[model samples]
Target: MTFQVARMNEQESAAWLGLVTVCQLLPAALDSQLKQDSGMTHFEFSVLSVLRFAPDHTLRMTALAETTSSTLPRLSHVCSRLEKRGLTDRFPCPEDGRATNVRLTPEGRNALVRAMPGHIDTARRLVVDALTPEQLDALAQVTAVIRGQLDDGRPARGNPFA
Candidate 1:
């Protein structure tokens, strides 16, 4: 089988490049702020934020991986790091002893709460404040379309925001 490939035209190329820049820059900006203010990377913040909202601040490791759109190996590695810092605790899942569960500690919750204001400010400065309300709504709709396509056929994971 063969597939045809073509170069992007001017408008398409501009739109694609803009999307790529957002993908590359946004996370780095978010991470930089989180790391500087909270000593946690954005991914770490994200994981903690998810766990903070989980039932009893606890979830099976597999469930965390799914919720965070993370690979098991990467999630395990991060979980180990969090454990070392006493931000989270990992234990045998009661429902399945062979599986693991992670719970956020009080310290972790404190860190997340402290990080929240700065993170929100960074997001607003970089994105929300940069766009008009109409543009923001349009951006959300467009991204939702793209995200839906990307997540198609996967289990639906709630947004990491509270």
Candidate 2:
């Protein structure tokens, strides 16, 4: 396949650039705040949080990866780091010898307890507080549409460049 530059004017190109910038920048901003204040990267925090909410404070490693939208290798690496920190433990699954389960350690729970309020505050300040009720609803709708399109194996609507 060959690609060619579209005939977008300078203003349209600038807007596209801005969209890409925000997508990259927002996560970095959140991660910086999270690391400085909580000593956890966003991905680490997400993994810990999901485990924290699992039944019996444990989940199959594969299930954890699915919930976190992470690949198995990536999640395994993160789990290894957390294990080294004494925040989690992995054991063979009770019913399936081929599978492993990850559980939050007491220390991990403590860390998450300490970190959640700050994370929630940052999220509220950066996103929730800035949006009106209607904007939030619209944002949800837009994202859901995109997600549904991807899930349905179809091209998304409304954005030609998507």
Which candidate's lDDT is highest? 1
TM-score of 2: 0.81
Scored by Cα lDDT, where does model 2 land? 0.83
Which residue runs of candidate 1 sit more than 4 Å off their true CA positions?
Answer: 1-3
Model 1, span 71-133: residue lDDT tens: 999999998999899999999999899999999999999989999999999999999999999
- C-alpha positional error of residue 18 in candidate 1 after TM-score superposition, expressed in Å: 0.5
Instruction: Residues 1-162, candidate 2: write the lDDT tens digits.
Output: 999977989998896697578689878877887899989888888888888878898989998887776899999999999999989999999999999999999999998889888888888888788999998898778778757866586443222101
C-alpha lDDT of all candidate models, in order: 0.91, 0.83
Tell me the deviation in Å of residue 20 in model 2.
3.0
Off by over 4 Å in 2: 1-19, 153-162
